[model samples]
Target: MIDGALAPLRILHLEDSDLDAELIEAELENLEHPVVIERVMTRDAFAAAAVADRYDLILADYVLPTFDGVSALGIARAQCPDIPFVFCSGTLGEDLAVEALKNGATDYITKQRLDRMTRTVVRALAEARARADKRAAEAALQALNQTLEARIAERTRELAEANAALQAQIVERERAEEALRLAQRLEAVGQLTSGVAHDFNNLLTVIAGNIEFLERAVLDERSKRRLAMMRGAAARGASLTAQLLAFSRRQRLDPSPVSLNTTVASMRDLLQSSIGGAVRIETMLQPDLWPARVDATQIELVILNLAINARDAMAVGGRLIIETANVAVAAPPTRPERPSPGEYVMISVSDTGTGMPPEVLARVFEPFFTTKEVGKGSGLGLAQVYGFVKQSGGGIRIDTVPGEGTSIKVYLPRDETEADGDDVKPEPVDCAVRHPPGSTPVLLVVDDDAEVREVTATRLVETGYDVREAGSGLQALAFLEADPCIDLIVIDFAMPGMNGAEAATEIRRRWPALPVLFVTGFADTGALAQAGVVGADGIVQKPFRDGELERKVARMLSARQAPGLRLVADRGRRS
Candidate 1:
């Protein structure tokens, strides 16, 4: 029902009699909502009017001059399917009206009982509105379903991406943990190797010194030749020990500000000749490269070792390219092993040769982890390079593809100072000093090793000094306290109970004017200085040549006699 007073209801009437249409309109006028009606008599007018205009209901006559009520109902059903259709006729029989109801008409009323017209119209309009509401509800539900499905799909994609990023982060964390473990293992091994080399160097020095004495005493050609062979074998042993020291980062270094380009350029001829005609050598030195503070000779050794490894890989010949550049690391590098953000001097060596596989590359920096045949390689080459670079406060990166090639990059921290020309050159000196004879300088030699103590005493005696020996720092201290005649003290840096530095500290307190020299295999000068033992003359490595020992001892003694002269030690000649 339209409440009888709302907006007008639009109605279309298909009736032949104008009076009959007015009667039907009057019947609807009593109902809710004002009625607006259009009368079309012929079937053509009814069809044309329904198509052109929208309406709320359709009232038609069962019988007409041009068309019947059934024809009008059919046209209204086709043109405006949702509008209510009703037949009103004076001669509409009950059976015909029932038949019309079954054919899509809402209701049919006889003119004799036209009072029911308003009730039928009200019921038809209500049903029409209910149908429209149902359709609208179904359409809104369909739209909601589509929106929910699209949102679900987008959320699923975002979750998948987050999962993938988490997986990548897990992998990187695992790799970093593994690298840390490898570093710890290498450090422990280096410490052990250094300890063994320290003792081995002392033994080798004894053997070499005795061999020299035998060579001078034996005059026969066969014996002299045999002694020379023994000396050569000892020298080779010394070289091997040196390699161990290098890999363990226990070898002495003379660090200075040096240009990477200049160092690489100077080694060009030597590298080419050593690698031979089979391999081609090239350089791409950056003109404005920054200087780095490092041991120039050791850096050259690192390059040479890498080049030699490259040459060996290229059995059929290949090209070796060395490049230097100044790099600014503003963020973490693409390679994880490189240093953190700062300026650096980068040296890259690339070779067009057989590259290493993943497994070999992983273990390449490990000492004695070689891929070569039984005796072809000692396997310390890359290890030495790794130690040298790390000890010089640098990082190394290696990139290789199985069949492509290999490129190794070394990044050393930048030194703003200019490069020194004599960075790699050893200090020139006359080590053969004539021993001055007056009162023989009473010297005290302290070492935990009995053989080292005996050998050192023998060398001092041969060099025109009265020598005394002690097996430990405690023994040396006891000896010095008992006899105040000792002119100088030669103590091993590392001892069992009390170290050389501690003994030196005690000696300095008791005898402030006494000069002391420290001997060790460790190359950590900063550590030694912290222990109150400083100066190159005051520190000497084990297995030193007789001339080196003599020169150092002579210099210290000369300084003692002339209190005015300052005692200075240059590591260049000490090595």
Candidate 2:
């Protein structure tokens, strides 16, 4: 309510009798704070004046000539909704006045109660203003609540969108991590295969050379026949070793954008020779097929391996079909394994052979899991195919039934660029034919393996080197301390007490100008740098060729005289 000290009450008096209006005006004038009263006799006059200016209170007579007090109260309510309306009637009874108060009238005054008129008007006006202020406060509070709800809803939507994006990023990261782990596992298998292949190649070289020497020495027919069998077995072992290296992905790869049509056309003769004259080979290559990114030689190997498997499946003659086509994976496949979606060039090999059951098909790509007889297959063919396709960022699928034929599909990623024009062919090098000269220098062979040391020393001596052998780092150090003129030190990396790297360190510390060569079967060699052998004179992988050993020794000895510090020469040799 507005304090009476700040604002005076504005009263509208509606009555037909001029005397009654004057009486109410005089009653209000007697108050300490003056009230402003505007008198209107007709309803038309009341409404016109109320539209121009509103009142804080309404005083109406019960009976007017043209209208009644009830009609005047309505006019006041329409113009100023919260104003107090009171009735002052000469003929209105106590019951009728009570009825008016129930119908929105604040209070009523009879003609007999002239003294109570002023106090009733003041109290009625104060109460009406209090109700008005409360309604205003409630409206403002409701508006503020609506605004807060809107803000919270908007923030909730933003959080939902952010959560969805975070989930997508997590999925992509997990996929990349899985692919990296698979690659590392393949690399570990490759390391093991490389070690095995190196040792097998060296053994084959010895056995084959010795067999040829015995053939020249032996004259009996039975001895020659047994020697021929041994040579044949050694050759087969060498072939199996090569396949293992290929399946483990250890063989060197030279990748290029290759046309499937051209590669298949060139391999017609070789495939015929390998598969024999029984199976009929057919090719259905798309003329405008997209090129694939892969090593051509490895792809050839994959084709041959698949053809051989097809031949084995069909003991009798059967038709083999090789088809090439372009494919696009627009969405993830509906398999449990979610393969990536992209463009690919698919090469499918289908054969009308004795098909495999589900059991055989499931284990076809596992290494050494073969269906052939014990001595007939090495079981690395399909494993090599799997490794090749996976390494090229692609996938493979196989379909087979018990009685129906079998089909294997290899998907290779498509390259957008055209094949290069040069496309120079690579020349094959025969390592056995290129033997080093038999004039070996003074040599020091160091190995923790007693057998390896003895064999290497014997071979070097036969090639005309004054050979010395050491079975440990301490033994090599002792030998070096006694004879400083030893030409080269071939040290093994894995020794029992002092390793080859430590032995090389001690040798260099004593004789700064000494030449040291490391021979290791292990893949990682960075440890040599940390052991103070910062620059090695040379590094030959273990089970090396006679040519490799001889060439490395000659190169290191010749580099020592090239007018620089021996350490500098070592650095140049390593580079």
Candidate 3:
């Protein structure tokens, strides 16, 4: 999608000559910037244009037979105070030019020196953008402050009410109850964020898919730049949503057995470069470290996050020590509040920096809770680490002293299964998609969202497949029964009735060999596993980039065959 912020610059030109307007358009167009210009000559026309349309810059002649640039500038200032207005005239005195500048004209350019037009227009527009950005930042900060204040006020009121219930029990029960409520509230927020992320991911998918087509269609440098900007923004949004999913513990994880020592040693250069020359990094790896079941990429991220946090805490030079060890957890009174009993692999990050205070420590793992000033940190770093550790069926502990330093220990469940290799990945199926011998591949798209369903089906159709849409799993089954031509099913995991997983389970019971591709947002892995969606091959995360959906579908279809032969390999009955 072309966000207004990144769209072509809209220009309002007040020029009497059609030829001059054309020249200006040609000049601006040749500057390699996307632009749209609307020419208005008469005073009334200028007035109407100023009021009717929003523009980034206004270009006007210094003097016309009937009206003047100053008058038009005044009108523009009154109508669009923030827009940049400049004068391009054939004749104007130095005094008049100074007067024009005093009267709010961004700049004046003589018609003879049209070469300066690009510089003037670019500068004016750049200033306008800077002002708009500053205002936006201020407004966002105000909104964030207001929100934080409101939440604090509400929490205080709730605590006050609890205090009133029993004066003596207030202290003890309040702490306990507050902890309970905090846990419940965080859980609830995680669920809500997960659902919202899902819907948002669906929208992003449609937007990104269309953008891909646009990227291919537009060949000009200017248009490509605009598309590039939009694509970059979309990628950033995807990254942020991924962080939210990680913090919410809904991120789809791919786990395998790997040595933590190897993961840590691999980051030697990255840690040094990221932490800078000021901080010294040391590693203490045990001779025998157990392999733990984990996502190697995520473990790398967790370590990076902790290192960055430690770097931030230490304004001056400090030492960072990363260590790995094997530990057996006992189910005794020792640290009974946590961790349970199990064999685990531990990765510890210790920093000789200013440690967090009690207040900051209390909410350190909470999402969006940060001690650093705004913009320095997202607060999701620790939250993501916490969620990833917990979701991996592991534990995390923080030891800190206010004036001393901090140590964060992450425990990953020890894997009994021997590794085929470090962080071994499943061998992929045949990835060459071919059409059925006698028929074009027919695909079924099941999604509760009409827009998402349409987008998915359209992409498949454009890819040269016969596509069918269903708003529900029941409807999908009905379609499957009506047409025996569906070679693949691309269905959303979260739906109103009979979700993708459930539907896939039912489909499997009826026909076990059919390829089912699960589309989802920050999804519940427990549900998918219970419903029997196979490994990463069967699932695609939401807000997928341009050709991601296509690639996933192609891979799934590559594993399929002609309808009759496919059926023969599975159950005999076809619904």
Candidate 4:
């Protein structure tokens, strides 16, 4: 199928001269694979087209009748971003082209030097398409294998069920064996995805945020339009990072005790709509299954992800079965990779579809491992399921073979006394009253990033607060000392000279009544608490919403005036 092939390269050309466009089109036509070209003579035309969809490469002339290459470059960037852009001009100076490259153009090619133009275009397109194809294939294979494994496991279970009492022990033994194998697979996959997800997510956050910021700064109307394409690419990168984080189990989750039957029943309509009318989804809940502690939303995400994978695996049609049961693990199963014995709630998903080989199975949970074509799958679905289960103190098992179906079983630790289940509800906290609207209360904004500090300070000033800015913890303390009237201090945790904790300690010592809010990207909650910044009045993680920051600051300031609010810093320092 064409879907299995690398995505075709799409090129957009912005040149005032029709000859230049024709030349580029001719060059691309001679490439090995099919090349799609879209041409635009004016900056306005290019801007309008760039936002329609992503292009593999953009070729812009350095000079246009109404606009220059730089202006066109900006428009192309705004509308179809991150795709490589090359300035092809006969009259553009070498120095200017170099400057354009520095300003974010992928490459600058002179018309006389069009010899390498075809090669550059072909190479870039090939790389992009190859990546897209590889990703798609990995997703397809993972889905196929998962479906196959589910069916095989179900068949094995059924055969074991037929023997009744004698086979019961054997079935239990096999289940344990299966779990051990899954654990090993998960551990290996988890280690790899976790590291990649962590680093990749950090980078994505920066890239995506900055790209959006740049999009807003584009001056020309046409250039501004091109930012949308860049934004889309950034958004895709963000989504991929999110998948990686979920698979790595580094994603923040809200866990609760939930009944599989109830949750699935509620989501039936949504699931049915998602899978379409072609594929069948069946639910088989045990008469009295135990409630399991898990993130209900995440569990739903896992189920949906698995079901979508199943649907894809069965290109023609297939049955997807979701079942639940209870088991007691008295001792760790005999399987070499199994967990310690305990009560467990098992949720199994099975499907009948094209299966996978042993080689694919081994790397199934690796991030970016997919069978679908490039740009189709991020290859983090099962890896996410594995990470979620392991992080929540559970286990997962899978069994399958090529051409056969597949079954995946997730085993969560069971609470014996609450086996019958009690009403589970999320309690809502009445968020403290909106910060009393008043003068921005003498706000101090501290951040290592100059841009963040400036923006935040401007925002605060706009809110009517007399804002002071500091680039580091030491600088903040110096500012505070010189101006003791600073009513609120918003500090970034990671800073040179002195960290937020140390600065907070010093601030508290001199100005006991001062309210401090620490912002950080670090995930170590223990470290924050140990530094006497526990509870609602302390630290706020980075990437915070404007309202969250405002509210936290307001609440902390309000708490300072409360007679019973305990000052922990002084007590801790004394102890």
Q: Tell me the TM-score of each prediction against the true structure.
A: 0.57, 0.44, 0.42, 0.40
List, residue by residue over 167-272, the lDDT tens digit for candidate 2.
9889877766765665565566667876888899899999999999999999999999999999999999988787766666566677777766566655667877
| lDDT of candidate 1 over 273-390, digit per residue (tens) | 9899999776665544566888888889888999999888887998998877787768654433456687788998899888999889877887888988898898889888878777
Superposition error at 448 for model 3 (Å): 62
Off by over 4 Å in 2: 1-8, 31-54, 71-80, 111-114, 140-183, 197-248, 252-254, 259-291, 296-386, 389-575
lDDT of 1 at 24: 78
lDDT for model 4 comes to: 0.70
Cα lDDT tens digits for candidate 3, 1-575: 12245478789999998887887788787557678888888999999889634887899998887988989999988998899989998887789999999999888888878888888888887787788899999999999999999999999999998787678576657766766776677687678778877887887788788899999999899999999898888887787778778878899999886767657755767998999999988666653456789998999999999999988888897999887788887853122113557888999999999998888977787777888898888888988897788788888778999878999999898876642334433332221233446567778888988898888888889988888776667556545433434688898999864678887877667556677888898677888887777689878888777888899898887866544543321111122
Candidate scoring better on lDDT of 3 and 4: 3
What does the lDDT read for residue 53 in candidate 3?
43
Predictions in order: lDDT: 0.77, 0.72, 0.78, 0.70
- Considering every candidate listed, which one attains the maximal TM-score? 1
Model 2: clashing residue pairs? none
Taking the tens digit of each residue's C-alpha lDDT, what string does model 4 give over 1-575?
A: 12235567677888778787778677666565577878887756777777735676788888878878888777766766657778889987978988997877877778887877777775655555676678899999999999999999998888777767667778887776775676677666666766876787788788878877887787887877677777787687777767766766678877665766566655666887988888877666553456677888888888888888888787788898877778776765454323347777888888888877877876676666888888777677777776777667787667776787888777887754465445433232111222233434668888878887887777667756778776666445545433455567888877665677777777776566677788877835665565567685577766777677767776877765642222231110111
Comparing 1 with 3 on TM-score, the higher-scoring candidate is 1
Q: What residue pairs are clashing in model 1?
A: 4-32, 4-33
Error of 1 at 251 (Å): 2.5
lDDT assessment of candidate 1? 0.77
* lDDT of the structure predicted as candidate 3: 0.78
Candidate 3: worst 10 consecutive residues by lDDT?
566-575
